[model samples]
Target: MKVLVVEDSDRLRRSLGDGLTKSGFSVDLAADGHEALAFIRTYDYDVVVLDLMLPGQSGLEVLRQARDEGRDLHVLVLSARDQVADRIRGLEMGADDYLIKPFDFGELVARLRALVRRRYACKNPRLRVGRVEVDTAARCALRDGEPVHLTPGEYAVLELLVRRSGTVLSQDQILDSLHGGEYAVSSNVVQVLISSLR
Candidate 1:
């Protein structure tokens, strides 16, 4: 899945991006609300890790604009604001989930996964399309009862397909969701991944 991390702290942004990428997610980083807004408008992100206290536009404004524009993407507010009012406000503004800073990396990843699943309206963790079954929480796939060893990128692609089984996703859609508008995606890359999966 594609994740946009909107954080003001350089270290936190890098850490979250690197970790999420390692865990089989395509992640993009935006230091403030402007960059985050630009990315949000230009690309399709499954979720955005937003911080409330930004340099220019606050995260709330960004969230409000996204909702007003009818973008159906998930927003996970990751802020230092841990108070009841802040959390309620974020959710009230259409954030899908909220996590406090000084948070556990594992928990953040888990939450993001859950949010994506919810976006797809997938209730089960085990998503099965024919004999190709995906254990989303475990982040593994089984083809005909055999485990498939895949690279991080390959797994990300497969997971997206498995989630949207029986549907057609264009190369642009795949690229937009997987790379978060960073890479110049070619048809060859998507072809290669599909071939590899087969």
Candidate 2:
């Protein structure tokens, strides 16, 4: 999955980036609300981890604008504001989930996964398409109930295709989801991945 981590704190941003990358997500970092909004507009991300307190614009404004544009983006507000009113406002303004600061990394990851599943309208962690089954929770795939080993890039692309099974995604969308503007690869790369998946 691809995720955008929008936090003003450099250390927390880097830590979240490294941890989420290791946990099998393509991550992009934004320091503040302006950069966060830019990334949100440009990329097709599965989930966004947004900090409420930001420079330039507040996170709520960013969320509100993104929603106003009608982007199907799932945002999880990660803020230090633990008040009930704050959570209600965040959710009321279109946040999918809200987590307080100093949260468990594992819980954050789980919440992100749940949001992605919700995005795909998937109620289960295991997804089946024809003879292929993807155990998203396990981060593995199986064909005929047997293991099918895939490179990380191949798996990422396959998961993207599976999540948007009925929709025809453009090459640019695929590339954006897979690399999140972090890599400069040609369309041929996506073609190769598609061919390999086939």
Candidate 3:
């Protein structure tokens, strides 16, 4: 999974990115809200780690803007503000989860995993399609009780498709899900991955 970390604190940013990367998530860092907005517009991210205070724009503004644009990005607000009102405000602004500073790295990972799991239920944990089963948490696939091997990219594409199973996900949508705030690859790439799934 890919995550965007929007934080102004250089130390915390690197620490979060490094920790998350170690946990098997692709991480992107944005120094402030402006950068965060630009990244969000250009790429797709499964979750956003946003700080309430920022240099250019406040995290609340960024979150509100994204929602207003009809982007369904899952946001987890990380800030030093720990008051009940602050938490309430962030939630009201559409943050999926909120965490205060000086938090346990383990807790951060756990909360992030939970948020992603809840947002993309079929993608984060496991997906079942007919007799085929894909275990995302384990990064494995099974067909009719037999194990199936899949390359990383192929597995990512299949996971994206199965996650939204009744929906006819366009090539761009699939790419967005897999890349997450990264550059969009060719639609033909998705076709190639789909062929591999067969």
Candidate 4:
């Protein structure tokens, strides 16, 4: 899944970006609310890891603006605010989940995965489509009981297709979700990736 990490702390942002990337997520980092808003508006991210305290605009304002646009964006507020009222306000403002700082990396990754699954309305971690079985939790795919070794990009495309099984996704959709808006590539790149998967 693609995620935008909106944290102002340099160390924390880098750490989260590195950790999330290693955890099999396409990650983009934004240091403040304006950058975060730009990233969120320009990219098709599955989730945004937001920090409430930010320069210029606060994370709450970002969340509010994103919600105001009526986009079904999954946001997980990662803040130092631990009070019940803080959490409730975040949820009320449109955060799908909340995680306090100094938290476990595993739990954060798990929560992000859960959000992606929820977005697709996929209850099971393992998705089976005909002869191919994708173990989303394990981040692996099996065909006829044999493991299929797929590159990260290949796996990402495969998972996207599998998650939206019945829906027809255009190449542009795949490109936007996987590469975001800044990475420029040939129009046929997605097609080549799909062909490789086949």
Best lDDT goes to which candidate? 2
What's the lDDT for residue 115 in model 1?
89
Q: Which regions of candidate 3 fall more than 4 Å away from where they truly are?
A: 122-138, 142-146, 151-154, 157-198
Candidate 1 displacement at residue 34 in angstroms: 1.2
Model 4 lDDT tens row, 111-170: 999998888675588888899989887889999999999976677788888888998998
Say which prediction, candidate 3 or candidate 4, comes out ahead on TM-score: 3
Candidate 3 per-residue lDDT, tens place, 141-180, comes to: 8999898988877788877777768888777766655643
Per-residue error for 118 in candidate 3, Å, reads 0.3
Best by TM-score: 2
Residues 26-135, model 2: lDDT tens digits: 89899999999899888788899999999999999999999999988999999999999999999999999999988999999999999998886755778888898888
**Model 2: residues >4 Å from true position, as ranges?**
122-150, 158-176, 179-198
User: Can you write out model 1's per-residue Cα lDDT over 120-193, one digit (the tens) per residue?
Assistant: 66557788889888887787999999998986557778888987788889987666565433344455777777
Report lDDT (CA) for all predictions.
0.86, 0.88, 0.85, 0.87
Q: Give the TM-score of candidate 3.
A: 0.73
Backbone steric clashes in candidate 3, count: 2
Which scores greater on lDDT, model 1 or model 2? 2
Quote the positional error of residue 12 for candidate 2 in Å: 0.5
Quote the positional error of residue 25 for candidate 2 in Å.
1.1
Model 4 segments beyond 4 Å from truth?
122-152, 158-198
| Alpha carbon lDDT at 123, candidate 4 | 58
